[model samples]
Target: MCGIAVIISGVRINLSSLLPDFLSPCPELQQVDYFSIDELKAALRRRGPDSFGTKKLILHSENEGRVLLSRFHHDEVDTSAQSSSSLTPDYETSLSNQVNRFGVPNSIGELLFFGATLQLRGLNPISQPLVDSFGNLLVFNGEIFGGIHVDCDSNDTEVLMGSLEKCCSCTSLEACHCGGEGNMSVPELLSAIKGPWAVIYWQNNSRTLWFGRDAFGRRSLLVHWPNAFDSRFLLSSVAPTSLMDKNSDLDIRDGMNNLNFWEELSCGIYSITMNAPKADGYLAGEVKRLDWANSTLKELVKWERTLIVPKPEMQVFKEYSLHSNGMLPELGPQQFSASMPAQMVLSALRESMKRRTIVSKRCQQPVPVAVLFSGGLDSMILAALLNESLYPSYEIDLINVSFDNQFAPDRISAKAGVKELSRIAPLRRWNLVEIDASLSELTSEIKRVTSLINPAETYMDLNIGMALWLAAAGDGWLCRECNNDDDDCERIKFKSAARILLVGSGADEQCAGYGRHRTKYREGSWLKLNEEMKLDMHRIWKRNLGRDDRCISDNGKEARFPFLDEDVIRTLLGFPLWEIAELNQPSGTGDKKILREVARLLGLYEAAVQPKRAIQFGSRIARESNRKNFGSNRAANQASAGSVVIHKPST
Candidate 1:
């Protein structure tokens, strides 16, 4: 896991103000003064705590209708160059940390890169932004579960970079003019990978920059298009706003149209030619959207997520009309129904869990794995699967957070769920960490949490973000900290040292696990239900993943979703609508029926029958937030809980 950022500017702008989102005063992360360049680095450092580095590239316009690119490494001072910051802390060119480096933008454009490493993979830590011998640069924030082969002893970042370098068939950076050819083209290489990622790769030979989130947008990447604010284009793993020049698109002062600060970059492969004619001091080359090797996925704005969801073709539906005598008939309500993909789903989800949990450890703890555990169906399944994957010597942390203190739905279920896991994996130690928060604690974090989950306002977004932030932080007292049955034993408050948190995000989205799915089924039959599920899957990237990523990573721990793995999605997509769920049945039993069978296959009975629960409600954060923010739960409930945006703070 890592935090990666790229900045391309025509004019030398104060590098300091680039990420005022990290400034830390505005309610949550919104309204704020510009931060120093060093402070910006500090913010990203939270995501990648192991190591941090940045690189600078100066592009000089040439007389021969071309651009010249040169790497800059300035250790000496430029006596003649004065600082660009003279007004109002110069929220533009002021970088007190790097005196004269960004002082002069003596080139056509300046491309700056920053990367922080979490060091989860490989035998040793590999510092990034990783630059190779030929000058190709990469700052990657993700893991390579599988696609191209990766050796256990090697770091996935190193392996992925090597694979990408092999795909670079260009001869020289000076006269390169062509797209990647053959099977190993850039798009093909990334599409084949079965993991979540957000990448920024600089191809020195082609003088092109390739960057975007994986197909599902499983990782967070924000884009600030060059607007009136500044003649700048950049990408960052986690940033609230792209604090632009004074005339930029967003009005940060009033914070009315705050979503404009930074938008989640669409999920796909995007390439920008750096050598093209300069358009407003940045690359004039049109950003190209390369198609996936799978051939089913298209631009996401149209809303067909074929990469992970079922293909919506007539022929595919026709194929499902005829049922097979697959072993799945016994699990469904019908004695004989469409061939269930239960076994395939079980296999795929199992492997996905294996890929995500079976990784190296960090923070020097015997227990390196933690689950944002609500002890609900999705989380319980993950815990059981995790127990199957890790060694018996390793302990697992179940971080359950509740604003209601002792009796939130999630807190109660978590206690029950932990007992089940203990019975199943008797040799393994499970630390059920109970993190109880009050209205005051939530008040203290309003600004930071709000900022982190920007572009996703509404009381509901806040409640969910706050719950996730607290749970991922994993700080609280262990249920058995005293190791005694006595209730009066002094409980020790300790934070889970685990750096990796496994979350069950995609499960509900994939399986018809929401109440809406049932209603849709009743209203328009199978067609409505299918469409509803597709919509949820299609928009999960924009609606949930990015906000969730920002909140979770804020804790210096990476959140891995086994349910969102590429293969897991493909396997579920293979099953017809009938096989995925039986929404006609009551809440818990029919919703996500295929996954229920998977739970049963893993010997989980009670969890298999558990119902879907949203984190905000499960943790009871929404109830508390409604009482505090809206003065009554009725008002928030009357208007959709997600309907109200936070009041814009005074500038």
Candidate 2:
């Protein structure tokens, strides 16, 4: 994780004096420097604190003055242990081999710098990939996930280097030969990757810069072109406050003058400027403009389905059931079975928990990841799974934040759930913190930071605050419990400080725990229930990639839904709907029975079994807050309505 800034001034600006202030550790500034690239690198060092590097380059163009700056955070390459010379041929080759081993291209030099970090699992390395061949310079924020790959024999940088090499070698032999073998366009490369990303790629030859966000805005990248003293474009992870000099005659009242305006409109990676002549506008503007042509909502959905849905070859349950023969009923329309015993269901859940924790263990961070605990069933289950499977290897921190207001009905239940989780997983490993803030105050704070109206309102603000608190405690990954539903998923504030968030989505649908399934079952419509379940799953997939994922990305955190893991979903799909329905019964006596049973089998019964309370209900956010302040403003609305009535009062 790092902070990056670049200045492409129309004229030479003296940035030397401003560097120190930008780099200084200031709490108000989010420990990021506005003027100094070095200072920004230093601030990022505190986050990774293991390895850090800074690079700057000056690009002289016929039409634009470009000053490029970058900062990097690498955990594997120890900064204190090794010197700059450690990036030698043998080291680079070894890294290149690792890159190729992952099936990526070999692009050397700057490409190596960018590509090498991409292979590191669970790290978001902000980098710029520039190629002189296409006369393009590109910078990107957010993780591409498994989007780009190169052969083990090569890395991205190497492929780029090879292309450049071929271009140089061919040009030397034949002056008339146009650049082909060695030149790869940014568009071509971007289309190949599959993941969330926000990129700014500039074509120097055309004097244009292109900006775009991943279909689901996973990371926050704001563009500000202040019309104050002079119009200048600024981009940053947080708002750029340093640009607002006191002397600038810009009216802050217009809202543009205030740095807060930029934070309010978190428009991820949209181009703010395109310098194209009126007559030849299309030609120069074509490359630099925000190209959503490749990023339509439909296209993104297709890409998402391809990446998330598992192949038939990877279906574990189908093979397991097949081996069990006709004894295990076929998982189709005619094969509905009665509810399984709680113990049997618990066994399956334990296996799922074991699998997800193993995957999470691959994170390179030293500290155990934290969970944004809400005392709800989803989060409680997640906490339990981690406790049983990942406790010894990684320390699990539980951050339980709640609002104390008239809105809370189950406040006691929330507290009890927290105590229960601690009891089940030992307080020594789980540290729980409770926050007391009015919903109104939290709403104001969220508005102050993000500008946009949080869909979850105060609840969303509390979640973000909890994430920031966890980040402060040296935890970069904070787990959240967001089911696959659009509403549940919408509550996630991706712009929060946490880099990765683990969500428990898809479990309910796969397990037939949704209300729709119950309705169908009550109606004695098993076929309808099965169809509704499939439809729900499809909806989950679409909503995650389309609405929820994009919203989270806008906040800069990558959301990983362990429940949505193809293997898990496939297994749950085979289970009988009656069994699932019985498991999710809202009995006041205990947790959701089936899920708890599964948890119990995995030795996580205590964690998995919690009253099935929705996150919003658990957080105590007023479902009708939107309508609460309505009557207070009724007189004003009536006055305005009468003013338009054009009639005198009948006094």
Candidate 3:
């Protein structure tokens, strides 16, 4: 993923002015001082490390339409580790109190797009804020995996931009003759494109601005909708560190509640009509949501899939019947029998991983793939499935981290998982990169990690963010002896070179992998469990994915969740609850039972029985993590183990 942002307005908001004191109640009108274009670029710098580009498009309303006043582009190759090479920002349209007088102070007719690129495809890098023949501009921060045909060796951003340009009459997403049968709109074209993405489109002809994330919200897109005090409409790929302390009285926008200054724009396509009168000011863009192709499906609650009826025929396990007492029949593991549901899951997962990992790239190292391995069922299964998808000549990296000097459960399980993979694919080299960090190391980078996971304010969020951020950096020690023995092993500092990291994000939500799922089942049985899982799947993007994508991409590596594939989701939904999981059974085999069975089929016997362990807890990073923020872990743990708010900076 790349870092992309867009700011739209007539008059520029001068955010550089420093206020002497918090003298005024209406502070959003005060200054653009916090998140200037340079600052926004800085906040997103880490996510894209190859090229830095900026575009300032001047829009003038005319009798014909919104005329493009000027189009200027500055592109520079960034060789520094931090991509610190700067391109001058030209969005210096005069600021005025005209916005309040005419409509407040603002950058009204001027639109600016700033992008940093982490080039993943094509022989040459593509500088973005990409424009086409018809003047439609796009800043795309995502991969185009499926929807419309993109050549395996093509650049997705350029290809996607070309496809968008063909929507000639798409002022409203009602009619277009591109990427559709006869007519297609922005939402129609976008809905077809599979994979994770967030985009900002300038439909120059219609004076319409189109923006949205994939239905799954796999990437981060933060939106600060226009308000009375500020006429600027902003959409950013980063919310990590921008603006000042958002909770401060000085930082509050006049109309919106202080708590939600910036929101993770909900997934799905949206358009803002920009043809309103000049007096409209910040109110110019009238936003409207485009419905999904399947109209019967509730757009708001997409998880409630009434169409996906269970396929009883797909369940091959017949003997582990649940007795009336809510207990599984006493039987050995062998009696459970091989299952079609497990096979279906494995097949779908293999295809999902293949689409994510097998793509155009810059280099061919010995290792091109890595799994965020904990050696538990999900990670192990992903490792095994990825092994099947990639060639044996290419090595695989299993990055496992521990804050406790490698004694954490994840480290131990990761070792065991490697051994299991060795048994199955002896020719494949499994690099178990051990990432060890101390409390002092975490403390040193706490502010940065905290910023990266902004909008997510909890002890658990911090712990997980820190772990993933470090792990994605892939800086760790490699055991030369293939990690068979923890001690008495030769170690060398190593970092994984793989650009793609496969993670099992959606497995738990679909297969009852959490303790809460078990709790919901015990409390209200299957129906309750199903509802809880649906809720988890629906909200996982907000609670988990955005933060994960931000942290992982900051290291210039894309995190691919095979289980979260649309097909994988639909496939899992087709199975009956019993086929998905025999929750009445024990923990290791019951929770995420379908995944456990997949592991078993992959010959990962040891890993198939290991219970779920979250990244923070498994890595022991959660140990005393709340001490710095909260008084102790006690208050947070007792109330809502992972939901206690952590107050800090801008993110």
Candidate 4:
């Protein structure tokens, strides 16, 4: 849950101006020579407030590389470099008053890694920008789940790094030469994990830098080339257009093409070599994707895949095929029972929840956890499972973030659902924390999040980004300080008790919850429905996960998706058409029928059958944003404004 930055340039440009000076207002152009690493660190302080530092390395005589790391302020800083006796901020006490402490970049070798860790166990020797014994430097952002067999004590990133090394048969960084043989390739290692991450792996021996997102693309890595027509590159978790820069490719003043020079790294593996380009000024090489269905790690030639650096205007690719690729391990080739889809789903979800909650290595006491609860079936089922779990020590918070609007259906639904569940699951501590913000307040948050999400090409995308931004801002909460007895008392405010938020993101895609799925079923387009399902799953990486990651991680809170777990997907994929959608049935009943049944089994009768509603609609944020953007004439302007069309399939 931190921000990571990497800037590589063949020439010695102004380090401060090398990136957009967006963290805050900057001095006049010629006033400063080098950009303050602290300022760059400050721009991303929200990502990692507990600890922030930067590092630098000279990869080539003329080429310069820098890495920045910022840890969440709620977590204790690693004091190995400082005195052991010195007292640091207490994580518990600092939760409400998290502060930013900026310092000079901790000069390391030829690489600088910056990001923060939410896990208590991460404050140890293997902190981050961790260089393996082989000299393979890793600046990883996200968690790696430990399924049934892994040791509980090892850090997810450390274990993943070790596993990658073992699979590749690369004893040292020098062994990973372009043509050198290794047991596995980068894709093979990536295929084996079931977590969300964005990583930058620098191969010291090859002097090559490899970067990519998890199959889900749950984290972001934005790279900007000052001269789109050159090899100088700057990558950051935050949007690079926060402030105007003299060397920027964007025209920040006019705000027309600020993103033209910036692009998000797509959801696939890519490698960049240090060799000089031949014809085009752009780096030469083909970006290779692992042929999940055919390739193995043994064929280790130097990665020659040219990087696919997409333009800011182009829609991102949506082929994050986990099953076809090795993102999830191959399951037994047995058909699942048509009538028992609910049973199978329950089993899968139970296992996923168990695996996701494994205590970190250094965690000795219970910490507050949360669920991005919408009171819908997907979220309700997830909450029900957590309530039923044995982890009673944790205070489970139901975070329902919404905006002030015509009718707050999301808030109303959440309140009703939470009330109902509390009676059924009386043993669990399910505190409902409602975070509501004004449309005006959220407009700025939306603008801020846009840098990370890039501008939404469509109005629908903008609504989703705004809703997500409000949820991530951690700005509003229920006012607990007010007197309940007083009718006029301040009943709602802004506060959060949890550092981890669990979401049911993948359920809808796997179970055909979209309105289009119903239409496909009515038209007898089972194949099309299946394809759409796959497409949604694949597109989640870029469309939903990446933007969601930026918004939520901004608060230093990590998001976990049980529905997106490997085992859960496997079970869902095994289901026959009947479990996904019934051909002749009504839209709501047929769509996500299996998940509804599971919800019933968990005693969430109301939520079990609740029809699908996009977050923007359910939260009423979309309606409000339109009201704010278009004023009283929103309806009349719909056609020209590109308002989202809602389809209501016949029941």
- The numbered model that scores best in TM-score is 3
Give the Å shift of residue 170 in candidate 1: 7.0
Off by over 4 Å in 3: 11-31, 62-108, 171-181, 240-259, 279-283, 294-301, 304-338, 359-361, 627-636, 639-641, 648-651
Candidates by TM-score, descending order:
3, 1, 4, 2
Candidate 1 minimal-lDDT segment of 10 residues: 22-31
Model 2 has an lDDT value of 0.38
What are the per-residue Cα lDDT tens digits for candidate 4 across 1-651? Answer: 466776553322222322345231111112121233344454566564444444444432212222222122222235232222433332221011211222212111123455544553343545555666766656667676642134666666676677655444232233454344545556556655566677777665555567677655667777664442333456677654344233233343333355454566666665554433222221222223333211321221111112122223222112212212343333342432334557768988998887667666565534445778778888888888877664766666777767643147777677778766877876665656667666666535655555556523446666776666556544555634453223354665646646667877777777888887767656656766766776787677656776777777776677778888766766666545555566456755777888888888788888876878888778876667667665644562654443443211123
RMSD of 1: 8.0
lDDT of 1 by residue, 20-104 (tens): 4322111111123432344555457555357666777665555532546556542111111112322122123422122122332
User: Candidate 3 — worst ten consecutive residues by lDDT sum?
Assistant: 16-25
Candidate achieving the largest lDDT: 3
TM-score for each model:
0.83, 0.48, 0.85, 0.73
State the number of backbone clashes in model 2. 40
Task: Give the lDDT of residue 93 in candidate 3.
Answer: 49
Candidate 3: lDDT of 75? 39
Residue 77's lDDT in candidate 1: 16
Error of model 1, residue 328, in angstroms: 9.5
Angstrom error at residue 453, model 1: 0.9
In model 1, pairs of residues that clash are 10-281, 14-92, 14-93, 27-447, 28-447, 28-448, 28-451, 29-451, 229-245, 229-248
